[model samples]
Target: MSTTPQSPAPTGMYTPGDSSAWSQRYADAVMNTFGAPQRVLVRGEGARVWDDEGRQYTDLLAGIAVNCLGHAHPAVVDAVTGQLSTLGHVSNLFTTPAQVELAETLIALVYPGLSAAESRVFLANSGTEANETAFKIARRHGGADRPRVLALENSFHGRTMGALALTHKAAYREPFEPLPGGGEFVPADADTLRAAMGEDVAALIVEPIQGEAGVRPLPEGLLATAREITREAGALLIVDEVQTGMGRCGAWMAHHLLAPGIIPDVVTLAKGLGGGVPIGAVVATGQAAHLLGPGQHGTTFGGNPVCAAAALAVIRTLRDEHLPERAAALGRRWSEQLAALPGVSEVRGSGLLLGVALEEAVGHAAEVRDELMDRGFIVNAPRPDTLRLAPPLILSDADADAFSQVLGEVLTSRTTREARA
Candidate 1:
């Protein structure tokens, strides 16, 4: 019997000892904007990724909460590929069915009770672009008299000129001098938010759950207070959902977690919306919805067919698979497990957007992160003592349990090593 020659069992995509070479090449070719790359990832499948050195890792960060459906999700892949093959970019002068359908879907999810005409969407390419668009809407809605835009202290909006102005990090904002608008910073407390909502305020932007500042959640009733104050001041309440929306917080939008019958004028969204494809949107309602009229703002590749198709697919999958509810249940279980770990002081954030505050005695958060990475777990240290985990929404139960067990083991090992030392 003639047997087909067996292909060599694939060791890895890259040859052995190639990681250092790849890192050197990356340093030479790429800009140093993001410091150094942690690892030269060679492949990703579901919640697992392999580096150039052939080391495997369970992806807990999920590209900073952008991979809602996980890496190489078939739905996103097929949708993007099919849409690209059918029709790609067609400029703003033209409209594609995918773009229109995606917009309609977002409006339906974000404002369920409202009619199509009651809401409007402005598509962009990234979180920064989405925030930038919202900034423009705020400026237009407020007019020249109201130039001040209020943002909460420790809030993270985006890095663009306008969005950076709304972002409250001095280290990030101070370097970029004279941002687009008169940016005002205030605490997230109700009293501070109210005091900052003066007549000159164009908009008061706040994240539903602050991501960069250790995933801190806003106090209950503060959003309602913001709504009332902004309304009294004739200012817009812009909720920066870039990190908290698109099922990251077990809801289509984190605002849904608030008390009944609360709505913001503008909501900015990006990460996880397109299931890894680059896309962002600014959804507006009421008078603010119509603020951006003709000849005001535009983008060249904002609503390209492929990205829209990817977003539509992600939305469909989130609904059909009930990933948001899954994320809620998984988040609760994972948070409890993490809280039980040796070095974890507390667990913050909702759903998959979570942060594990490490005990100060556990040494540096960066050290813990490196140890976890060495043990095949990927997480982020947003602060010196906070380990952030924004894992994929579709992370399986087995994977979740495995990650918890591994994290516990890593912590135990560290403790043992410290005692030995």
Candidate 2:
């Protein structure tokens, strides 16, 4: 029999020479909002990834904490493939089984005591869209006259206009001045939030753990106090769990751990929800849920069956594998180990999400990250002095040990060199 000629592998497969071509293509086609990409990643398995250069690295960032189960997870893949084959997209005019199931699942997970009549779910395509829906719901609940939104300082909701208005970073908000009149920024403290709360305020949005601001968790009593204050003021307490939800913080939602009794009027979820399929949801309770009627808010691709199927798989995998508890244990272990290392001043955050603060303000955090990548580890430097780690919940003990060992060596070497310098 004549042997069939094998087709050539894709251009980006395991070759450094092909990296430039991919980067050039990316530059030509994509916007420069994120600057140059770090490395041309080819493929991944579990928490490990192979770059275009054939170099292997343990991915600690996990696509900015979006990959809860890591790369190419069998469950996620199977769910998406199966759903796409059977049914993928349908407008809001029609409801799919996956969509309804996901909504019910999220409602059950997010609000245990709340009944269906007291709450509702609105699906979207990203974290920003989820927040946008929440914003709209809050404004509607508060009526037209009182549409003010009180958000915390140093918080990052999303990049969309309405969500951007509530985001407090001047660097991000300056360029887009006069965003929306009703958005206001308050400090993270309870007293500050209470002072900001009034009849005019529609909602108070807070992140249980602020991800982009170096994994700063809100003070223990702060979230409960926010709920009380908002409730008394008749304003919604909207928790943005985009980064901290879906088992990332070792819990279904970070707010659940922070204040179990306090149920937010609105909760926005994304990031790890679909395990990389791109999905966002706004879970509203009480009157807030009833604010959005038909035609009030809508999206073309939101709640696509494929995304819903992916999310259902993610939720099921998290439960079946008990990934949340694993995240809790591993997070504590990793944080403790990293904190004990030399040159590491502090370690903050819960679960798989962590931020390591360097003693000497490592101005070259990016350089350290590059070096770490060379040494077969992947991580992120959110600030000059702080390194954020959000590895997959599926990351093995061996992987964690490898990271700790490498990190110890790097920190010691850097400390010694700095002392000499």
Candidate 3:
């Protein structure tokens, strides 16, 4: 039979030879949730990525702050590979050394100087899952009388049913109607937050730095005030540190930057915890730690050994490399330099997590993002006028300086063109 000689089997990775072919395949095979594929990324190392056609770019978003050590870090790869060969997974009915070790590590971070017994961890697989666990804890602590939950106006917890209720974006929440636990959205101002902390409020969930909301950080003492207010009202305080935790915010947790004596009842973490491996955790302290008892809440693959091992490696690497301190220094330098750019209005955020607000005359943030991509940079424009940068913690000062120079050039060109227009 003249079997059509199957076109000589292609070599190397399954790249369609160009981005358009991959985009078409993605449109046909994948869900359109995130719109069309931006680029068919093929490989990455450190803070850089290469697309299907071999174009390289500096990855500034770091998979939305999930890649703390950047892509293909040896620590993460070794941990994951070694753990899988030893013990890939064990159901929640049993525990592994890696699982316990990671939990202890995270608990230590949550309550430094105290025994790990002071806190409890429930591991999940994503920030949304962690937030969902925290939501259930709130309900369990609140019981029937306390039905109301509080969240900030510009907050973004997650997209799951329970987390969706807490997220303040109308577009994200409106479509997913009748979300499971009802919650009230309020401004992050201390006075408004205090007023919202009534007896019926089950819990007040807040992000130390509202990442999706243009990287807007809460006023320095807002979290501490939330702690006091929730304590007086007998309500739980849940801090969503999904994007700001794991050394992304110049500290182990962004809440650490808040005023002293700010202890959140429950803290949700994910994104960078596993250094790109999927993992999330709800670390509960004080009475909240005891709220979810045996058989109350569980996940089958939540604390799988492989993911735990990866997280432990990530933690060790962060400390060994002193990446958090590096992030702080680079963040300050870039913030100052970016703010001085011609078409930049302001810079917001802490550490490597940052947002640059463009002057109105500079045109749409989407256009700027495209221009940056064309010039070998990848960033996130979460809003019409804002560009967010959550580069890998390993980003070198030279890369930061390079970004600044390119950004200055782009801004100056845009301003000159806009002035003429």
Question: Best candidate, lDDT-wise?
Answer: 3
Most TM-score-accurate candidate: 3
Model 3 lDDT per residue over 268-351, tens place: 999999888999999998888999989898898999999999999999999999988888888988899899988999999999
What global local distance difference test value does model 1 have?
Answer: 0.87
lDDT, candidate 2, equals 0.88
Error of 3 at 416 (Å): 1.5
Model 2: per-residue Cα lDDT at residue 299: 99
Clashing pairs in 1: none
Output the worst ten-in-a-row residue range by lDDT, candidate 2: 1-10
Q: Per-residue lDDT for 90 in model 3?
A: 76
Weakest ten-residue segment in model 1 by summed lDDT: 1-10
lDDT of each: 0.87, 0.88, 0.90
- Candidate 1 shows a clash count of 0
TM accuracy, model 2? 0.95
Model 2 agreement with the true structure over 1-421: per-residue lDDT tens digits = 2233234456544455442466666777789999989888888888989878777889999999999999999999999999999997888899999999999999998997767767789999999999999989888878876778989988999988999998888898889887976998888887778778899988899999998888899988999999999889888899999999999998999998878888999999999999988999999888888888888999998999999999999999999999999999999888898898887889999999999888773436776787788788999987777889998999998899888899888878877777778
